[model samples]
Target: MTPPVASLWRRLLDWWPRIARILTLAVSIVVVVLLVKLGRGIDWREVFLAARGISGPTLWAAGALALSGYAAYSGIDYLARRFLNHAQTIWKTLAIAAASYAFNVNFGVLLGSVGVRLRLYRTLGLRHAATAGVVLFGSVTNWLGYCWMGGIFFFGAVPRTLAAWGIRPEATRAAGAVLLLVACAYMFLCATAARRRWTFRGHPLAFPSVWMALAQSGLAVVSWNIVALILYLLLERQVSYPDVLGITLLSSVAALVAHVPGGLGVTEVVFVDALSGQLGAHEVLGAVLMYRVLYQWVPLCVALPGYLAVELRARHASCGAGGHDLPEEPYER
Candidate 1:
């Protein structure tokens, strides 16, 4: 039997995750409410009309871009699993990832992402310790990709933005250098982790081959840039590839911090700040708001039905004595 203090500690530790989840939910709700109140100028009728005006071809192209991004993400997972020698089915991987993204779009990204990975590995009959390693590797690799993209954009684009804001060129260069160093440091750490087989909580994490990581990273950047271009096209009635890339990178970096659901307020603010010079204030607001409705919410609305359909079918396939079986615990993975 455990001592009373030890038992108390254990109980707290057991409930800690649920407590964290509840706090996240509370924060998400509050932030969303505040953002909605602040950005309340959104004209629902105008948004509706604007959405209707989106041409079928344009919608299709946007969806295609999104699908391409999903595929790249799934591919990254597959490669990671392969590298780890986990040997899970590709369809299982894809479904789990799709569920993850869908959950991320609805719930907060961190919880949804981890939850999806937990379930995916559990369902695939992977050990909890191994699953933990896979999740850690995948996260670190994806973030390395993010840092690389952000670093390139910082060096190539941010100095210009800063210079345009009347900062001295030398100052801008210095700032860019700092950003570059940070990004490089992050990449170095990730590389070290991958090469050394870093462990988190005693679970050894392994990354895919370097070439595979880089290829997936490249695809992720391109896929995101394409989505940004679509939004730019919709808003400005034109697309600037450079602007799209820069804004995409900026928004991605910002999203990591914002922690809002789907990076809601944070992404819009970053896009507006990045594009204000080219598009002006009102247009930036309008464009970002409009982009959110279509590129963010609308797709979620559409995809959710498909997700539900898939889930229901899956449920039906799993026979039970009386009712459906409950999902196993995360620790049971």
Candidate 2:
């Protein structure tokens, strides 16, 4: 409580945001380097041949699965809105959710997704608190679903994958147990502390009801599974579904931890490392490339124009209304 100590703490708090940004940038660079090193051995000729050999029907199926996956992901936003008791048409929510996710997958969540969501929600007339609530709810739901599915998959169905990764079966099970425990803890909190609110650094945090959490988790699981299915279809179903599921889960976790843009190289590196023996490196690389185009690039192409149109309309409205722009709101640090 002394003046000198208080001054030191205040200075540290002021520098925290800059420090965090620096750390994130450094980590992203490291991940990109690792990805390049991991991909050095891949044969592009084979990769291209594999891509070219993919049947039209298979490509169509993968595209359909990709669409379904994004649609399921949009449900996260819908559930978040419900949790916050915000009223918006499902169509509008879906539009924002799809566009934001497309941006997030390409540009990273912190830089693009959150900003897009905040702006879109504000333009839709929600206050800052509601926007933050929606973002928090969506993030929690994603983690909850990941833990639930990952715990189940790693604990029982994919011991071979653990062995391949040089992880002992016992250790893998223990890790799985830890994941399950974290998910269970969240559910317990929701059940018993639904009305509880906590303040952290001047921001209020609230828990959704148990049923809402369950719904959120379910939707996330569906979205993730659909994504796995897309990859499986792209690979011509050569690999077993369980193996694909495990690999997808590992890659997803790695990309999330790396915080790299679009998880670009992180995912491909993990996939190649994990499934090299099960499938040819070039074939796997090709399938991954195709999957990215459908899931990330295609969505991004659609989202960018939609976002611009929205911005243009907003600008025109502001100009018409006495030529003043809307006030900018500060996003959560």
Candidate 3:
């Protein structure tokens, strides 16, 4: 090949990943814009009135709860490290946590937590395989919490409510049956992995004590539920906590099933539909959108600069420049 042609080909190869990221970002931006536009002509006055009705105390209390949720989220990795017996520091974990969440919210599964972990693995001194294992176990733990929270309402509340809503009891029963089978399959996989003594680079999975794990998961669900309630309170005058919790939990589960990026329209639709009898369509939509913006984007906005700082420092250190010494390998799966 000619020298110029070969040089151009190498340059393209090097730029490919960056190009792909840019494309993904562009698509996400377009999706958000389209969804917002689709739900236009919203009554701003009602939204503003609802916002005004949200008591100052409630807002403050909700904010505090939301912050606690963030703490719990950061602790996910902390517990994972403790369980895995990795000697990683908290600061590194904090940065990776921020990056992973920001990426997951914006980019969905393609650039989910796994991607964030992969990018920050160097600082953690983990290889790809080890990092994958860490991410997998963390994901499983997180999902267990999600299921635990959903099951509470699903069994105790959803079934009764669905019947009241005129949904056939047999339909709910069928759904439960399907979910049971799925859960069994998942448990089988985890058990199989456990039996194999699978470890990324032999870093044994230290399963967190069941009680502690349950507590962590429970706190996570409550924190998130508070976030959801805050949105409803800000956008509607009358919504009981139990109602909000039930609606939020069920809708969240459904949105996950739809698998849309950040569950975008899917979540909003579910919220509005569930609350239709009590809330005007526009009011619910507005409330959900506002909450989505605040809960979903605000944290990432706060974390972005910190993540960038970490990345820059890691790069400089690796080049033997101004950055501090840090490991380059990531955990293996």
How do all models score by TM-score? 0.68, 0.85, 0.69
Q: What are the runs in model 3 whose C-alpha is more than 4 Å off?
A: 1-41, 44-49, 159-166, 173-224, 227-237, 321-333
Cα lDDT tens digits, model 1, 256-296, are 54466677676665555556577544555555655665555
Write down the lDDT of every candidate, Cα atoms only: 0.60, 0.81, 0.62
After superposition, the stretches of candidate 1 with alpha carbons farther than 4 Å from their true spots are: 1-44, 159-207, 236-239, 280-295, 298-333
Return the clash pairs for model 2, or none. none
lDDT digits (tens) for residues 74-174 of candidate 2: 98998876777776567888888899998887888885558998888788666788787878777788778889888987777544655787988787777
Higher TM-score: candidate 2 or 3?
2
All-Cα superposition RMSD per candidate: 8.1, 5.4, 10.6
* Backbone clash count for every predicted candidate, in the order shown: 0, 0, 14
Write down the worst ten-residue block by lDDT for model 2: 324-333
RMSD of 2: 5.4
Clashing pairs in 1: none
Can you give the lDDT of residue 136 in candidate 1?
A: 67
Sorting all predicted structures by lDDT, with the top scorer first, yields 2, 3, 1
lDDT of 2 at 260: 67
